[model samples]
Target: MTRVISILFWLSLAAVLAFITLPLLVVVAASFSPTATVTFQPFEWTFRWYGDLLSNRWLDPFLTSLKIATVVAATSGVLGLLAAYCIVYERLPGSDVLMSYLLSPLSVPQIVKGVAIVLFLSMIGFQGFLGTPALIAAHVVLALPFVTRMVATSLANFDANLDRAAQILGAGKLQRIRHVLLPMIKPGVLSGVTFAFIISFNNIPLSVFLVRPGDSTLPITVINYLEYSLDPVMAAVNVASMAFILVVIFLFEKIGGFSAQIHGGSK
Candidate 1:
């Protein structure tokens, strides 16, 4: 029975892996396909789609997504750090309630939130938030829950003695934080920032609702292209996007240990 179950488990795992990886494999294959169309057997290699991507109107959308993601990550990371610090360290009254409220966004369907925001914003004399500062604001809010939870977990696992020791040594709150607290929780901050950036960069539902024609993001741009043509150009775009993410992940690992940073908060 044990041996039979083991084989079954391996088969199940293989199935899951294939299911997840098949689309990515197809996208990469399409990226390198010589022809404009998608195919399974004939292998064709070309960089023309990349060039096309650069020349096409997609450039504007890429830039707009970059701008919005940048702003959302920075803003959300800072806000999350502050909120996490307050809740974790101070453990103030109703901190549990506040944390629940903040994290509730994660529990809700993202599309629902997107629609709700659009409706409310439209009602409040704002017809559209896409391509505007307000859109970034919405992204930041969505990303905040993840960032705060990460930082809070890090804070929770960290030793409190460092802060108390600093206090004993005549260090003020600000000084202690600068010297002790921040350094101890640096791993959490790094993880939070990394996640916040990735989450904001990849978010579709919110971006879809909030982005205007002038401010469409890379994801939306890809969607637009796919809608009109089911070609390898979309595949090329996906491959390029994956490559970009790989480079960023490499940089992240070089600057700070990504594994340690992320797992540090797991406890």
Candidate 2:
């Protein structure tokens, strides 16, 4: 009976993996299809759709999304680190309340948040802030909670003894933070920053309302393009976008050694 149960469990896991991966595999295949219509035949593959990606129509939105996501990641990482330091290390009064307030955005529906931001901005007569500037602010609000939580967890597991030792050795507050605390928490910070970039890059609901007509994001651009046409070029665009994000993540991991940090965090 035990053997039979184990076999079933393995089979179930395989089935789930196939379910999740098959559609992506199809999209990848479709991206290379020569015809406008999707074709799975191996002989029909071509790179023309990928070539289309270089055109201004797609490149503009891709660059815009990249810029926005980059800013969001950098800004959120710094802000999240500060918030975590205050809550965890300082043990500020009402820290729990502050932490909850910081994370409140996560609980609210993203559509509601987007709507609320737009309405508030309008009410304040900041109607001119609708495009890139407002989009960055909204994305920061969406991403900040995740970054704060990640940094807080790292801070919770941090060794205060290291900071104390640094102090005894004549290290000042800034030195201790710079050499000791920052090094120890580097993984969490990188993880949060990566999450911020991915979140901002892939966001649709919030971005839909926030993007200007000429300066739409990649995801929004893809969606708008879909309304008029359904072709293999769309698939190519998605495949290229995913590849770009993967490259970004790979570069980050190489720079920060995030895997090692994650391993240490697990222990």
Candidate 3:
């Protein structure tokens, strides 16, 4: 019975993995397909669709999305670090309430936020700033809650004894935080930054409401293209974008030791 249960567990896990990965695999395959339609036949593979992605229609939005995601990641990291420090390390008055308020965005629907932001901007006579500026600000709002939560979790799990030891050794507040707290919680910060990038880059509903006429994001552009046509170029765009995201994640892992943190060995 034990062996049977173990076999079933493995089979169930395999099925879940397949369910998650099958669509991505199909998209990857479609990117290389010689014809517009996706197929599994080995002979139908070609790289022409990738070459077609060099045009301005795709490159413009790709650059815009990259810029937005990068800015969002950096901004979220800074704000999240500060918020986590105040809430978890300092334990300010009503810290729990403040933390809950910061994360309240997570509970609100993003579409509602986007629409409300648009209306608010219109009311304040800031309609001219509705494109990239609005999108970046809105994306930051969307990402801030996750960033705060992740950083707060890391701070909560940190060893306060280490900070006290640093203080006893004559380390100033800034010195201890710089040498101890930041290093220990880096994994969480990096994870939050990566999440910010992914959220900002892939956001559609919010971007749809916030984006200007000429400056749509890559995801929005791809969706709009789909309205006109369906082709392997869309698949190529998706596969290429996914590869870029993978590269970003790989770089973050190298710098942050996310795997080490997972194994409870991060320094």
Candidate 4:
């Protein structure tokens, strides 16, 4: 019965993997197709759709999205670290209430938040912020709760004896935090940053309301283009986006020493 259960588990895992991967495979194949309508003819495949990505039509939005995502990631990481430190490490008065407030955004639907932001901005006559400024703010808000939660979890799991030991050894509060606490939670911080970047880069619902003409994000631009036509170029764009996300994750993993951390944990 144990063997049978193990076999079932493996089969379920394979099924889940296939379900997630097959669509990405199809998108990759479609990107290589020679025509607008995806074809399976390998001999007819061309790189022309990818070449189109070099044009300003695509490049501008890509750059805008990159800039916004970078800003959002950095901003969210710093803010999250600080908030987590206060709530979990310092354990300030009313910490539970403060934490609930910080994480309130998570309970709200993104679409509702997006709409509320738009409405609030309009009412306040900050229409000028409708472009990049609004996008950055909205993305940061959307990403903050996740980042804070992750960092808080990391801090909660931290061994307090280490901090006490450092204190006993004459380490200042800032020194211990900078050297010990930061290094210990580096993985969770990087993971949160990476997640923030990806979400900001690919967000559509929030972006749609915030983006102005000629100041759109890559995801918004791709979606707008889709309204006009169904083309292989869209597939190529998706494939490139996935590749960029992978590269970002790889860079984060390197910075966080994730492999070394895993090895240390195993030991």
In order of appearance, the predictions have TM-scores of: 0.90, 0.94, 0.92, 0.91
Q: In terms of TM-score, which candidate is strongest?
A: 2
Q: What local lDDT does model 4 show for residue 22?
A: 90
The positional error of residue 223 in candidate 2, measured at the CA in angstroms, is: 1.1
Candidate 4 residue spans exceeding 4 A from truth: 1-17, 40-43, 257-267
Q: Taking the tens digit of each residue's C-alpha lDDT, what string does model 2 give over 1-267?
A: 999999999999999999999989988888888766655555655999999999999999999999999999999999999999999999999999999999999999999999999999999999889889999999999999999999999898888888899999999999999999988888888989999999999999898888888988999999998999878899999999999989989988987847967678423
> Over the stretch 1-267, how does candidate 1's per-residue lDDT look in tens digits?
999999999999999999999988877777778775566676757878778778647677767766777788788889999999889898989999999988999987878888888888888977755465766877887889999998898899878887788899899989988988887777778767777777777778877787776667888778877887877777777787768767766776676646766565233
Report the lDDT of model 1 for residue 245. 68
- Candidate 3 Cα deviation (angstroms), residue 112: 1.3
**2 versus 3: better lDDT goes to:** 2
How accurate locally, in lDDT, is each candidate? 0.79, 0.91, 0.90, 0.90
Worst 10 residues of 4 by lDDT: 258-267
The C-alpha stretches of model 1 lying farther than 4 A from their native spots are: 1-9, 262-267
Sort the predicted structures by TM-score, highest score first.
Answer: 2, 3, 4, 1
* Model 3 regions lying over 4 Å from their true place: 1-17, 40-43, 265-267
lDDT of 4 by residue, 90-188 (tens): 999999999999999999988999999999999999999998999999999999999999889878878888989999999999999898888888877
